[model samples]
Target chain A: MQKRNTEITVGMFVAAGIVAIFVLAMKVSNFTDFTDDAGYEVVAEFGNIGGLKVRSPVTMAGVRVGRVSNISLDGSTYNAKVTLSLYSQFNTLPTDTSASIFTAGLLGEQYIALEAGAEEEFLKNGDVLHLTQPALVLEQVIGQFLFSKAEGE
Target chain B: MIDFIRSLGRWGLDTLQRLGSGHLFLWYMVKGIPEVLLRFSLVIQQLQSVGVRSVMIILVSGLFVGMVLGLQGYNTLVDFGAEESLGVLVSLSLVRELGPVVSALLFAGRAGSALTAEIGLMKSTEQLSGMEMMAVDPIRRIIAPRFVAGIISMPLLAAIFSAVGIFGGFIVGYGLLGVDDGAFWSQMQVKTDWYDDVLNGVIKSIVFGVVVTWIALFEGYDASPTSEGVGRATTRTVVHSAFAILGLDFVLTALMFGEI
Candidate 1:
């Protein structure tokens, strides 16, 4: 009886350990929203990524509608091609919908934010989003600020 | 006054030269390596007896540590309006620094002192001498098991500590602290590098195990075979091992962070 009790306790501890590891892995992997949201694929190109990585959210008007699926660079153009999986239910994105790389907050993570365009035609799977803004380089912004300040002086 | 100043300066130079040779320490380390490894294996067996048997205490302590980290981190970050970053803060701090160090310290306090005292008592009773008459190597027979146990128990305890702590943090942070589960995890996913934190923790545990076990064994082996000697050895094992752990932590941190 004592042996059986000890075995049960050991089993319980092992089970708890396994559960904790699973929880940690799930948390670290961002395994939320595993249920497929209705979505279609669209592509955008940018000159610089600025720590923007795959699996980053694609937000429309501050609401996450999709996520970055893949990031690759065009061999000849030297442009980064970012593939976004947008929810199919939100088909309001026009053909001219523009994408911009923006930070969530000051010193926060970067995400691809979409600005819906006024055009009537909706974007389709495999559609290339032509109206795109690249990441704002911090050095460029600081340099511009300094240069403008110097000119004002 | 001139002679005093000159002597003080000479003493300082000699101290610097001794510190610079550091090879003397390295030689001692080399000489100890084989004995350490043998003792390490024996310590592993002892862990089966001591640590694996003490699962309840380790579990409860680990959970509490995790819960505290989460609750405290949440409150602090919320004050700054960065509540969502609780996951990153908890996971990084636990896995990188707190988990292994805290668990090892606890293990040393519990099992380390016990090992030292047990060996010290055996020495005082002349059981160690009896083993020597039987041609049994006391270092391998007596000291090795505790040393091996210490090394094994530390990593296992560290792993449990991290796992429980993360879970506890999650429970408190997400359940009570009002941080959204999704936001918490997303922040963690973005900030954490598994190789950097988890692997670093394991490496630290290995080094900690070595240091704690070695100190315990060394003290026991050198015990004066008297009651007073046993008491002194036990105290030294705990005190010296604690200092060694702190010093090695600094060295490892510097090396891991590329300060070396």
Candidate 2:
């Protein structure tokens, strides 16, 4: 009976440990929603992607549809080439869909926001988005405000 | 003055000798691991004593730590008007630093001391010598299973600590405070990377397990066969394990996160 009790308790302990790992992966992290095979990659180029990170979310109309998989400089165009891995369910995005960087809240993370255009074609793998807006730079906004004020004077 | 210098030299020599034997003890423990696996019941018995018994303390402490983090994090973050980030702050700290380090400390206090005392008492009672006289290698028959159980238990305990702590944070943040549930969980999911944070925490706990268990077992095995010696060895095990854990944590954190 003592041996049986030890076996039972040990078994329960191991089970509990596994469940804890499951909770960590599922609820506390983005692992389930961010698997590689569940998404298709598309490239978006911008003049500036200020504060944009690799794993930043790609959302359409405030709903997260994918994530930024890679960010690099486009050598020939000197633009920021960002590879977006959009979820497979959102494959029918218009070929002329516009992607813009938008900050969440007042001082929150930056994410790519997509606005669909009137295009019959759908964006496929290796498709480069042409209609893109760069991240808004706070310094530039302030400088422009000052310049316009001086011009008014 | 001459006697003082002679005693200093004696102390230094003793220290070096113990260090050498500690490494040798580690090697024998490793060499005995196969036998431990072959006679797996020994490991199960140790697992009950070492691992299963430690669960209640790990869970309770984990919850309390998480709750404290939640309350403290919420207070600090509310000042910046960034209370929505309470989840990120709570989860990151718990998973990255607090979970493994604090749980290991607790494990050292609770289980590590017990292990040292038990083994030390066994030595003082000459049970180990009796086994040796019976042609059984005490290192193989006794120590290895306990060592393996400790190694397995530490990571699981840390994981439980982190998980329970997160739940505790949620209780404070959402139930008590009024942080949006969606914001709390979504921000946590967005910020905490599985590979970087959770995996690294696991790695830290595993290393801590190996170090703490080795220290406890070695101190016990090397204890002089007397009551006072057993007591002193038990105390030394806790002190040595704690210092090794903290120092090793710094070195590991530097290696893991220093560059990036």
Candidate 3:
């Protein structure tokens, strides 16, 4: 009985180690977020999304309040339709809040940053954020810079 | 010129002889596997010696490796103004490469050398011969359990090493360096792939486990039954296991990454 107990314990330890590795791998690689957080949804339209991806964090005043749930293209307008899943508590965002896709740091990741404005009306589900800004494409900026430099030279 | 040619010829012959002996020794080890199922207690005892005891060293080294990566990754990423990616950098390095390679090297140094010395000492004492006289196969009763334990322990140890190392990286990246905690985690969580980084690491460590254990046991079994011979075998186990691990890692990595 004692010997069997020892073996069982050892087996458990190994099993525990394997589980830890799985969690660490997922956590490090960002495969699954534990909190599949429940939240409300809103829509925004952009002329260009650049390289923004689904699940990209939506921030307000530099704090993450939601994530990009889905991104698609409108057939007529050629605009990108992005769905934002904001946390339930952050549903108090005013209807006049401006949404923009901004790059972090100099060349870091891109995210949807929201700048709130004064409005008595609060945003609700299915509401569209009217004021939207598009991402600044680096290639275009570099191209313009080279063109200006060539003209100056 | 003739002398140089003759010495080179002799070295080649010597290597062939060692390789032949190692192969035969592995055969003997494998022949004992059926007995392991009946002698489960032996496997457990060996597991305790090989796995449970080595946890401390593996954890400490893993922690240090992570800390070094976190600190260095921060410095480099800061130049690009992207320090927030530290979590991804540290975890990816540890899981994909450093975790398996470094842990195997440490295993060879600590457990591999010890197994060789213990088995060599047992042979010198004539216990193996004594067991044979009593109608017991020492390979089945003695060596197989240790072999099984080693193969089982190594991958788990590597896993533990990688897991703890990430936390060490976390402390250095978020706690000390002031990288945004949210960005540190969310960026890493979103970017890391389960199959490419994590599974590959586990596979690499499993291969390492087999190689290190095989060399250690074979060296011990083939050791001359004397104190000096036992010491030499122990030393050879460490050196050969380390070399085999590095060589195998290169081949395995190439096979995994190369498209052709």
Candidate 4:
């Protein structure tokens, strides 16, 4: 009976451990989304990507629909070529959809924000987004303001 | 100066000799694995002792650690008006760093010390010598099972610690502080990647488990078969395990996340 009790208690402890790991994966981290790998990749060219990183979320109308899969430089154009992997369910984004970099909160993470266009043709895998706004560089914005003020004087 | 140099040289040589024997001890434990597996009941018994018994400490400490993190994190983040990131702050810190590290430290103090004392006592009592006289390999019959149990239990305990810690953080952040539930959870999910944070934490705990158990078993096995020796071995187990966990954590973190 004592031996049986040990086994029972040990079994419960092991079960609890497994359940805890499951809870962490499901609720705390993005493990479920990891398994949902059905997605289409589209490329966008930006003048500057700023702090945009790989795996940064791509949101349409402030709702995340995709993530930045890759970021590289186009040697010829000197543009930042970013590959966005949109989930299969969000396949209806129009061909003319515009992509822009937006910062979350004050001094927060940067993400790609997509604005849908009124076009009949939908974007497909490997399609390029023509309308892309670069990330807002604070220094450049200040520089432009100073230059404009000097010009006005 | 000559005497100091001679002592330093002796210390270095001693350390080297111990390092060589530790490796051999680990190899013997590995060699005994097949026999240990064949007699799986032994492993289960050790599991009950090491893992099952330690659950209470792991859970309670985990909860308190998490609550403290939530409170401290909220206080700091609130000043910046970023209290909505309480989930991200708590979950990331717990999953990435605190979970495995703190649980490993506690495990060393609790289970690791216990293991050393138990084995050291067995040695001092001449039970191991008796088994050897009966043509039994005590390494196979005794040490391997406990070693294997420690390795298996460490990761599980760490995971439980992290999970419970997250729940405790939620209690403080959402239940008490009224942080928006949706924002808290969504931000955590968005920021905490499974592969990077959770999986890495598990890997860290596994490594810590192996090292802590190895140190405990080695110290116990090498004890001088006296009461005083066993007590010293137990103390060494906790101190050495703590130092090893912290040192290895730094190296592992650099390799896993440094990107350099």
Candidate 5:
């Protein structure tokens, strides 16, 4: 009976371990999505997106409202096109709400930062964001400095 | 002086002989793995003994490690005005390196020593000889099951260590420290990749499991069936497994993520 209890507890231990791993994998790594994930899509274009990836959060005034749903290259315009998924609660972004890619902190992940515009009209699904500021490339900034210094020399 | 030199030479020869014989023992023990499949009870019992019983130590150690990371990472990051990235540092460190390497070290000390001692005790008790007299292969029944169990339990223990460690970090970072709860989790999600970071960690733990268990069983099976021998074997298991875990960790890290 004592051995049986240890076995049961051991079973529970293994089960709990597995459950914890499942939660970490699915929740943090996003291996699965059970939610309806109710949200609408909006698109923005930029000239450069440094280290931006799909599923990058879209934040409005420092609050996460959605995520980057897709990224593509505009062949003709030579621009980067990004699709944003705005959650149903945060669907009130004005048509002119500008999107810009920014780093959250120094040496941190890249995310899309949204700035709400004063327009009374709100953006809808498949609507394109007219104003976008490209991602700031730190390497480009450093390279520019080096070139300028060389010219001065 | 000449007599002492001859004795020293004999001692060196004995050590070499033991090493060669021990290698053979390990080889034969591993070869019994196929036989283990037909005898599931043996493996299950050892898994419970080795993996399940060792959970508390792994968890407590993992929790402390995460708390340390949270506390230390917060202080260092706050200096750079990036305290919110605590989750990133904690999860990445735990998942990538500490989870596998530390847990293996702990497992070596806990389960590895226990395994060596138990097997050594069993040998000294003549139970192995009794089985052999009954025309049963002790290697097939005894060592293989424990070996297989260690291999199975190791990765699970590692995963548990990492997952719980992350929670410990959450407690320290969100509950104690003033980091924003959302930012802590969101930052981790954004930063950590499943394949490159998480899967590689699991792989590392699996590798550690195989190597550590192999050493534990090898030391036990090869130790002379005596009290002093058992004690020595147990010590060797811990020392050998620790060194192997560290050396393997460095090599695995380099192969998985290093520029070279």
Candidate 6:
């Protein structure tokens, strides 16, 4: 009887551990920077998204200050419309702040990296940033390098 | 020259005879299908006994596999300055291939051979013949239960393996390895697709279960009606099941990924 009880308890513990791990995994995957009512929104338009998935970090000079909220298409222009949720404390983004999809390292995931521009005017919420660059596809870069090498040869 | 020709003829005859016998054995399996199905219900109960009860081992193994993958993957990626992509490698490798194949192989070794040996022993003792004489279909009674049990056990075991493995990775990578907790979580959420890897693992296990049970039951039923035959059958069941699993894994992977 004691053995049976011990077995059951062990099974329960394992089950609990599995559940906890799964919950933790879910929580980690959906990580966000927005604090309670303390974040602003901005919009950026891109020609191509490449592998820019939603919830990808929006970093400014290597510091993550926001995240991608939504990705849609402009019906008339056929451009990729990206909505970004910036932290409320980081409201001093210049009007000419350029948003570009950049990679961390070779063979790393793509992120929306923001480079602050030297402008006097501060950008407001929902204001669309002018300068934007799409993700640099590896294939294209490789192809260009190979083509240039061949031409030089 | 005459002696050499005679030896060659004899070898050809032997090969033909062996091939014919193998074909007849396959025919017997097909002909016994109705009986196999009727016996399958009872096999389901046996599988519950073997597969379901063995969940603890499967879970533990899965956890260990996941944890090791996490630790190793993180270390390798960190060296390359790409530690955050560990989720992609761990989840993809485990789900797409390792989870089902490893768990099924373990199940075959632990339970599959035992089932074959038990049934082979009963056959050697004429216990199966006694049932046949009493108008009882032995395939329905003995073979079906094991077959059903294997099919039921494999998928469940594979699922436990995948879940446990992922969790193990999390514990080792996050808790022990000290990967940025938030970064780890965010990477997994944004990158991992449960449907692609997890579902594929379960499906592969189901196919593996059927193949393992079929090979085991086939060897057990066809054993020579002797004590020695039971021992031979047990050995053959394990070896053949392992080979069949590996072959099927290759085939299934190719089919699933459209590699063909």
Model 1 off-target regions past 4 Å? A1-101, A111-134, A137-153, B1-45, B258-260
What C-alpha lDDT values do all the predictions have? 0.76, 0.91, 0.87, 0.94, 0.87, 0.75
TM-score of chain B of each: 0.81, 0.98, 0.94, 0.98, 0.92, 0.83
In model 2, pairs of residues that clash are none
Worst 10 residues of 5 chain A by lDDT: A27-36
**lDDT at B85, model 4:** 94
- Residue-wise C-alpha lDDT for candidate 6, range A4-40, written one tens digit per residue: 5544544554455355335433542231222235487
Query: Which candidate do you rate higher for DockQ, 4 or 6?
Result: 4
User: Per-prediction TM-score, please?
Assistant: 0.65, 0.92, 0.72, 0.96, 0.74, 0.64
Select the stronger candidate by DockQ from 2 and 5: 2
Q: Which 10 consecutive positions of candidate 1 chain A have the poorest summed lDDT?
A: A24-33
How good is the docking of model 3, by CAPRI class?
acceptable
> What pairs collide in candidate 5?
none
Query: True interface contacts reproduced by each model, as a fraction?
Result: 0.20, 0.71, 0.68, 0.86, 0.38, 0.14
Candidate 5 ranges with C-alpha deviation above 4 Å: A30-153, B1-23
Candidate 4 CAPRI classification by DockQ: high
lDDT of 3 by residue, B102-205 (tens): 99999999899999988898899998899999999888888888888888888898999998888899999988999998988877776666766777888999
Model 1 lDDT on a 0 to 1 scale? 0.76
Error of 1 at B134 (Å): 0.7
- lDDT of model 3 at position B169: 91
In candidate 2, position B4 carries an lDDT of 100
* Model 6 TM-score on a 0 to 1 scale: 0.64
DockQ-superior candidate, 1 or 3: 3
lDDT of 5 by residue, A36-92 (tens): 375799999999999998878899989878888899999999899999988888878
Best by lDDT: 4
